[model samples]
Target: MATIYDVAKQAGVSPKTVSRVLNGDAPVGARTREAVEAAIRALDYRPSSAARTMRSSRSGLVGLITGAISRGDGSAGPSGLPDLFIVQAIQRVVAEAGMTLMIADTGGEADRAVELMATFAQHRAEGLIYVADSHQRIEDLDPRGTPLVLANCFDAAGTPAVLPDDRAGQRALVERVIAAGHRRIAYLTLPEGMIATELRSRGYREALEAAGIAFDPALVIEGFADHGEGPRPYIASALDRLLALEDRPSVICCGNDELALRLYGELRDRGIRVPQEISVAGYDDYRVISETLYPPLTTADLNYRGIGEAAARRLLALIAGAPAPTEAEVIGGPVCWRQSVTEH
Candidate 1:
């Protein structure tokens, strides 16, 4: 195997000069750099990453812990698909920053995170990022002095984090629905007690208040059971409650795209025509559900990719000695206007 000395000898330069050219830590004359490059190509020399790490004390690696890849088999949280989008975006940003990303899958086991962190520490990863499959609170992650960032989740320990702005997303979606002339808007929400559910519900109410529409608790209903109780547990009942109202809603805002898709079926079963009779809106603009629906659902993009990118940037900043943020950074996406929502 060709070594750096072999290339240096071939290029007629000292070993220190070769190291400078390889590391780009010091400037070399253009001609000297060109000669070193030619010698490297001729010798096909490969530098030892271990040696580089020892000299610079930087592994040039970022550790990412996530269950998104393991959940690719479709066993995801209540939101539907795994957070693969977030992971992909993180990978892109880290690569662009000239750092390698080492991913560790927890396989749906939250406890495995600590073990994974230890493994990353063993490798001397410059930073660590934990990405949750959903927006929620994560606890008990001890970074052990290595810079850490949470993506799509936040820790009470005040670790830097990037999370989807659920409240702002829901509020924006509802505001769009209101602009479409929906005064009697019914909201079919996720099960109570979830972080996203609570924030999005508040957003819905805030949007209504901003539009001068009185908030009616009667129009809000749980659209599904928590913890995967059943495939389509409460859709029919929720729809029944809304339809039975003497003053039926002109439009219904679903907690997410999955619920909106299921509600479409229930509404069809009852011979209701979408948009013509009652328009519908959804959240998480999941393309599979939103685009394939009859009229193409109007929804909000959760900006999972943006969240991931922001998380990666934050982690890199922390690695560079930036102070941790006191509050989680929130990312928001635009509302997608489609044919499903019509003027009342």
Candidate 2:
């Protein structure tokens, strides 16, 4: 087990310099940083997690409030980010900052989340990162004497939040679909309460309008983000309505790959041909539901990893007693194209 002093000695730098490099407290020259990094790697140096907490009055821990531990559909736990693969990456960032995590499952209930927030405060958590499976409008989260940040949940208050740039992702998707000559495109979404979902829908409509295409409210249909397991029955019923329409859309944009892929089973039951009859597209490139589907879904590769890493960086700032920048910190994303969409 190599110590910081040993690493400092190996790099021929003072222990303070090594600490600065680790904490991101000061700027080290690129060459010096590279040397310090190499010394750490060569010596297999690891920081003392306990040392950080012992030296600081702050807990060296921050709470990640989420509904991740429960099932949706009004179940007793959470179900989103963990399903989307962001939580673990979030943990990695916290660890690098020499901080620990305290996760509280809200069971997807507002009352539970409020209570949990208070409990984390009782534990003297330096700050909080409110994470959701998707974007949600949570009320009264006021930071309660602690600094707060939203992860995967954008803020209307212009507070600090980290979200995958769905606007960029969706705009690119719509542009390609338009370039392919699809004029009548429908964006199927969940309810507008979630920021990410609503933002994606807005992007979809904006893209169409920007191309001189008329926006049709009729083309957008709202469904569910989490049905816990299996497709919601309304999904099939909605597809039936679209398929039965006299002038159906040339392409359908889903809120996510899971919902987009559902079209296979839902439409196939009616013996409809994909791309031939109506092309479908999705968001959030979930591999299983996207790749292995009847036609692999063309969706957005929303950088969940980037979002998690950004969130961890924000949480670290609060933990270190640094003032958070007033400017909204945004870490944006991109798109993933598969075979689900086609030209008119």
Candidate 3:
């Protein structure tokens, strides 16, 4: 609770001198500086960041708004906690640049975003970052002159953004499957409306066309909702249909690690042997599902941390009055080849 006035009084100096010593704004005698430092240590005095911000005309604080809710009772939804990997990466970079990060969660409610934005603006944050749970378009956010950056998402009106290269990531994974000698590859994609669904499906087709394989409509199935109720009945029916085809696919590519996990159980119950009768692969190398399975899964990394780092860099540049990047930053992760995929 010690203030500059207290330090000044204890040091027998004026408050202006104390400010000069603390902020190096002006020259102070060595003896006076030493006296102020001693008083600061003696009283355990902490300079008020707000006061410093007002004097310097910069807050040295960045606000981050996320969709992940932190329940006090320690509960996580089926998708587990929101992707904090990106936030952690952003924090590290921002701290390296001598700025502190202030985070607010939207509790998965989009309506709460405006309130959070207003709070950050009121606090005079140097910039703000809006991070979505996944790659998608975020709308209705008014930056209010505070430099804003989007992480793991984008805005339709062309705001600065950092996102995973969903299409390229999927293309790379499918290319890996093809390299393993799987000619007939089936894909279980995310819901039709999802941004990832469209991008990843495009990648799937691109990879097939690159390999001189004709795209097979029958092998592509839309994924079902993940209600944590084992695998959906529709998924099993879809799998059965794929398996019954005259030229059945030799490998099944899942939308994500979670879907692959559920599919693993469903495939097991049907007496299908992984990598023997059929091969499997997934996206989003979510360790809990990808690494824990009896056979580790082959999947694509989302590179969320990379996204965070890019967003931080972009925000910092914008805060420095640099021109905003014309295109969204697209980061790509490597393919994690594990035991789930087998050579044909």
Which candidate's lDDT is highest? 1
- Which regions of candidate 1 deviate over 4 angstroms? 4-44, 74-77, 226-229
Candidate 3: lDDT of 3?
Answer: 89
Off by over 4 Å in 2: 1-55, 72-84, 122-124, 142-144, 154-159, 192-194, 223-233
Each candidate's clash count: 0, 5, 0
Poorest lDDT segment (10 consecutive residues) of candidate 2: 72-81
Instruction: Give every collision pair in model 3.
Output: none
Candidate 3, residues 142-229, lDDT tens digits: the string is 9788999998878877888898898999999999999999999999887678888889999999999999999999999975555465
The true-versus-predicted C-alpha distance at residue 5 of model 2, in Å, is 25
What 10-residue stretch in candidate 3 is worst by lDDT?
72-81
Global lDDT of each candidate: 0.89, 0.74, 0.86
Write candidate 1's Cα lDDT for 144-258 as tens digits: 7899999988877888889899999999999989887789999988878789999999999999999999998899998867535664656877787888999989999988888
Clashing residue pairs in candidate 1 are none
Ranking by lDDT: 1, 3, 2
Q: What TM-score do all the candidates reach, one by one?
A: 0.89, 0.72, 0.88
Better of 1 and 2 by lDDT: 1
